[model samples]
Target: MARYWDDHTVYSQPSAEELRRKAKESASTAKKKGKNYSPIMPKSRRGEICTSWWGQAWCRNLESYADYSSRLDRGKGYVRSGTVIDLQIHDGKVLAKVQGRRRSPYNVEIRIGRLSEENCQKIIDKCSTRIESLEKLVSGEFPEELKEVFTSEGGLFPTVREISFGCSCPDWALMCKHVAAVMYGIGVRFDENPFYFFSLRGIDVDRFIGVALENRVEKMLQNAECKSDRIIDEDISSLFGVI
Candidate 1:
């Protein structure tokens, strides 16, 4: 039941509920056709699109560098209305189904280039001494110095060239409203789980944390037997895997 359109097709947008119904029908059709049709709906229809430093930074990155800023207004409304019926994040790619005026949700795929080894190493080296814990990192509570490293040019954030997207909405513009909604939805996901950004960039969080802690850990272990050192709680030790 998905709809396809050419340049000549003009659409009178449908009600949000109608669009949602269409998306459900399409998912049903896909399931009948033996395709995976699981859809991830937005957690809320009436909250900020993004919150926290990392999430805001993601939205800003897309607006500041990408030409999609103009169409972002259209998408903000869609995303806030819960028109983004599904979104899936993966290493180097984001897949989504954005409900539109068409007969079904439009398919959206965004390709994000993996952060290069050199850039990743640079961030690790710059932040190794400053980051206090993995929890802080994932919660966007890291120090300002670390934030600078992440948002800096050629740093953790992606540039325009490192991103490419396509949507099945058939709009001739450079980026359609459906694509914009998905982009905002991506930011919302970051607010929910910041690690999604790392996964989207193909970065391993455990490896990054371990490498960053290597020198400090070695020093701590070396000094332990030479002098008296207080032991941490069992749960804390187990949580950090230091036991």
Candidate 2:
């Protein structure tokens, strides 16, 4: 038997050994049960939980609030130890399974509210003019102006009030360590698919690209008056940098 974090059954305080043991046992049990996992990999050489622009921002947002700061610290260790087994993102929902001392993995579900109409429109309008295409946005390389659009009040990321989560763990705390691990796991998932952010917020990313396409059409129409009806080779060279 191994000591585990916040295990009330054991009087001994938890240690790094406990987390490692928990991780090993959890992984083995999960595999035996044929459960697919989307584990958060260990921190990078820089010791950052998440490396990409979107991923880092998600962690920063989690740490910014006093309520979640302390709770999230333990969750960070859980993620590093690979106790969070599987994480799935759906429209306005994130589902996860975190293994602990028990034979079964704890289920965690987090619901993020949809962005307000105003906020969605704000991102759409701002992103349209700034982001050249969906590829650049999903690649996590975009203009700095988009940052403000995403992080501002009532922006893309959900606020405290807009988030609600629950875990099947025995812990009495409102946000049990198991649930917190899943929360942090969401950030890790972002590194794999940036589009999940929009999906989690229940926003249509196509709108962002649609706005850009519409703008391009408007510009081409304006240019048509001064130039030819069809896009010429010179225009292609200027737009795509291709001859």
Candidate 3:
């Protein structure tokens, strides 16, 4: 794994092989011919936004992305917090990744202390009915103490603001524990319904696709219109001998 430095603290640790290679490179530079050569190995740069210790731990705990995703048979939830879903490279455009939990106190931790997916599934498999019942209770299907969490003044609804995101927790971070917990819970829900992930993030995948198509169409139309206008202007100027 690659590492990033932030505020005098190393967020991720390099893999064993990378560390070994770096050591060898440094040694080679030190044994040069005549001129003195600095023995420091150059660092190879990678992409921004990396998986933190917490995030990677969650994945390892969950078995793997494929297995975890398989549990979500399209009804419960999904991981929709980050802007980038997976690392994809395209032709010329390099879109900055929008997701991946960086190890920083400044951000919310959605899956910090959760059990690995494989282990959690074992528990659920052992007690499916009980787990389902708990889900319904917390969801407020019937009146109970859990209703407070989803009520307007209680939990589900929150105050909106233009300047600030309007989080009430005292963490002084971009997102509070509440936000992190919500995100983490959504990941668990994803084990039931993967489509629920986008819904939780307030994103309509279909609408996003439509918007992208419209943007491309508009760009093409603008290019065509400009070309036609230029041709017409040149023809008129030629006819009037004003070129």
Top-TM-score structure, candidate number = 2
Ranking by TM-score: 2, 1, 3
lDDT by residue (tens digit), candidate 3, 172-227 = 44543334333333333333333232233333434533443455456667777664
User: Per-residue lDDT of 1-243 in model 1, one digit per residue for the tens?
Assistant: 555743355578777777667777777777888877435455566655576677778777777854677798888778776677778998889999887877667889999999989988887776565436544664555555467666897676788788899999768787888888888888888777766767888998778777867755665678776745566545876788885
* TM-score of candidate 2 versus the correct structure, residues matched by position: 0.76
Best candidate, lDDT? 1
- What is the lDDT ranking, best to worst? 1, 2, 3
Candidate 3 regions with alpha-carbon error over 4 angstroms: 1-197, 228-243
For model 2, how does the per-residue alpha-carbon lDDT over 1-243 read when each residue is reduced to its tens digit? 656665657434356456557766776777888975666665652377886777888888888867877678888877777777678899999888876766567889999998877777767666655435444775555545577765788777788889999999767777878888887788888877777888898977676567655765676678678856564655666788786
Q: Which model is ahead, 1 or 2, in terms of lDDT?
A: 1
Candidate 2: lDDT of 100? 73
Instruction: Tell me the lDDT of model 3 at 118.
Output: 49
* Candidate 2 Cα misplacement greater than 4 A, ranges: 1-34, 131-135, 138-145, 219-243
The runs of at least 3 residues in candidate 1 whose Cα sits more than 4 Å from the true structure, single-residue gaps closed, are 1-9, 24-47, 131-135, 138-145, 218-243
Worst 10 residues of 2 by lDDT: 10-19
Q: Which window of ten consecutive residues has the lowest lDDT sum in model 1? A: 1-10
What is the TM-score of each predicted model, taking all chains together?
Answer: 0.74, 0.76, 0.20
